[model samples]
Target: MLKFVKHNLETIAGVEIYPIISLSIFFTAFVLFTVWAMTYSKETLNTVSNLPLNDDESLTEKHNF
Candidate 1:
């Protein structure tokens, strides 16, 4: 099954560039996200990190159906 797929891909023109383009896109996004995370605010990070454990009454009131 792998051999059949490889043979079919080899027959297609310009198919090789698809992998390079996809890899470039993934690498660019990964680097940008890494930079953003490195520079993110520490105070905001603390607030967001505690969101799940927060039990404020207003939050519960807003979400009540």
Candidate 2:
């Protein structure tokens, strides 16, 4: 089965670039997320991290969930 699929793909022109494009997209997203996480503000991180434990009811009400 794998050999058949490989043979079919090999017969198609420009089919090989799919894997390269996929890897490039994944790498770009991974790098962007890493940079965002590294540069994120300490205050915002603390606020979101504590959201589940915060006792103030106003936060929940504002979302209109």
Which prediction has the highest lDDT against the true structure?
A: 2
The 10-residue segment with the lowest total lDDT in model 1? 56-65
Q: Which ten contiguous residues of candidate 2 have the minimum total lDDT? A: 56-65
Question: What is the Cα-based lDDT of residue 38 in candidate 2?
Answer: 97
Global lDDT of each candidate: 0.85, 0.87
> What TM-scores do the predictions have?
0.80, 0.82
Model 1 regions more than 4 Å off: 57-65
Candidate 2 overall lDDT versus native: 0.87
Clashes by residue pair, model 2: none
- Residue pairs with colliding backbones in model 1 are none
lDDT at 54 for candidate 1? 89
**1-65: candidate 1 lDDT, tens digit per residue:** 99999999999999999999999999999999999999999977776676689877675465451
Tally clashes: model 2.
0
**Model 2 C-alpha lDDT per residue in residues 1-65, reported as the tens digit of each score:** 99999999999999989999999999999999999999999977776777799898786576543
Best-performing candidate as measured by TM-score: 2
